[model samples]
Target: MSDPLFEEDEVPTWIFTFADLMSLLLVFFILMYSLSKMTETTLESALSSIQIALSSNGANINQSPRFYSGGGSKLIAPETPQLADTQDLTFSEEPIDTEEREQVNEIANDIANKMVSSNLSNAVSVFEDGEKITIRVDGQTLFESGEAQLSYEAEFIFNKLIDIFNRYPEYSISIQGHTDNIPINTVRYPSNWELSAIRATTALRYFLEAGFRPERMTATGYADSIPLVRNDSPENRAINRRAEFVLQKDPDLQKLYGK
Candidate 1:
């Protein structure tokens, strides 16, 4: 009877303390996970996304993005352009596949043979540096002194060349026009630059008309910058004045050519 009915002890606040502790632990783990993958997160995410898209699981996600996004049956995607680089590239000092190398050589040889058999020996010459090939054409035969108009003989040669290019046009074609040191001045064109450009355009137009792939071809005018020999003599200058149709070599092979 010592007033026991009204007596009570102070209870410990354990429930609130435990909840706060649990919340702190959860936050610490989330932060650790984020820091661990910080450097490579975006890169890994992009690659994983691409891989998943290519897999069977992608079909489900792509068909119903809401399933993956999990936002009230709504799809979530960035509105801005994604910053990711995923380009296929190859790096090799030497030929990794001999079959590809052999095919290139065979193609070049076939072209060289065609040039010789078509009675274009004096006007055209084929040269091969490793797997790269180039067909040199005499501009003097195609142009009249300072003119860029194609002669009848040039038409025949180009006609045949067009057929060849249309058939196997996997190689890059460079049409570079060169000229002697002689200055040129005409009504429509002036200087070697304009004249050379006209010649390149003339040839390029012919190729395009003959159904050659435009992506693999380029038209350029070299003027008298690159000379085959000293322009001291008339014969040497004659050789310098030429138009070259070259097939490009692989960049790697070109670097290691004289090495």
Candidate 2:
């Protein structure tokens, strides 16, 4: 038997622990909501930065141009583009005058020296002027008189040319065929026009087969026209009937002209 005043009992403290846990959960949700609002503000600031880059003030846009040093629009006092858009951005550029001409002349001289070393100076002439690099192939060397067919010696010349052209893959070449006033009507080919066109086409085909890019090569026929000589005498007529290989300028350069 126990005394009534000495009887004891235990009460659980777990109920208070449960209430503290619920309070912590409520605090967590409130913190999360505040962070979400801050995230939206940060996103808006980032978008504003991009928008500023796209839409600039009209006054600064005109007075300054976008010169990209590190692919960034570094504006100067004056800048313009011949064609400028989001997809295709082109900048207006100045023409390369005397300096560019000198450089091309130097390159042509070097090429001529190389051909000289290879012992190909007679049939082929390589030179550069103000506008283009010219390669003049004499008809006397490439073909027989009044004929479009390539001579046996022309094959050797063509092989040497292939070696030279393969090295500089960046250049674009155009082969032009010219003839004298002497007309031709053969079974295989009819008329001087057809003969010249065929010869140019044949030369172009050789270039393509020898691993040249088709886009970089062009063949043109000029029959009894565009004569270097007066075509009056036999010697002049012989000189007039010739083939020329011309190196054209880069097409992208048009963007500089703004036309």
Candidate 3:
């Protein structure tokens, strides 16, 4: 027999459990939302506190995701790529030779040491990628204001560089000139492109005069298109205006050297 005070629809025992579950879920979601709103430092502190509390109670924590460090940028396409062929293709591997790598490293080290020894560190910087190495020279150090001609001091610097290149015949050289975003409308150089090109050509001529093989050398200009940094600040503008001596990759040369 049913209790006299209780109706058929009177609050069921299961309804209390359901309400408690819903309340717990709501609180959990609220805590998660609050965690998201925390600053990096605050989030770290909270995680540390939680970890300490768990450890004191004999709970084992395996690993935590590293939130501070970030990987390098990867190129991402906006949409799925359309391939003309759906067949699997044969792939080949030809890693750079160990000897070639050593040679490049030696050259870079020698150049860096020479620059430092001569107190030209302020005007020059050396950078290396896997396939190539580049020696970048500050534009202001090489030429006068709005002039393409290499200065006397610049000539001295090039002479030192030439001594280094004379040893490495296998590597092809490229003189790349870069200019700031400033507009130039002179009769000689109507645009930044012309100015940049002439500067590169001027440097090329220097190497040629010093007995470098013309076939192994080339010149190119990048007119404010590929700046190292934004041209918003004067310091950044100065950095953007520069020249680079790049050791180019040549498959034929590599093959000749038994790569």
lDDT of 3 by residue, 94-213 (tens): 466777667767778888898999899999998765457789999988987677889988998998888878766678899999877655556778777988999999999999998987
Pairs that collide in candidate 2 are none
**Cα lDDT tens digits for candidate 1, 155-184:** 998987887765554566889898765544
lDDT computed for candidate 1? 0.67
Instruction: Give per-candidate clash totals.
Output: 0, 0, 0
Best by lDDT: 3
TM-score of 3: 0.60
In model 3, which residue pairs have backbone atoms overlapping below 3 Å?
none
Model 2 regions more than 4 Å off: 1-95, 251-259
Number of the candidate with higher lDDT, 2 or 3:
3
User: What is the lDDT of every predicted structure here?
Assistant: 0.67, 0.65, 0.73
Error (Å) of candidate 3 at residue 176 is 0.4
User: lDDT-based ranking, best first?
Assistant: 3, 1, 2
- The residue-level lDDT of candidate 2 at 167 comes to 55
How well is each residue in 209-246 modelled by candidate 2, as lDDT tens digits? 88887878899888775666555555666776778887
- Residue 206 lDDT, candidate 3, scale 0-100: 92
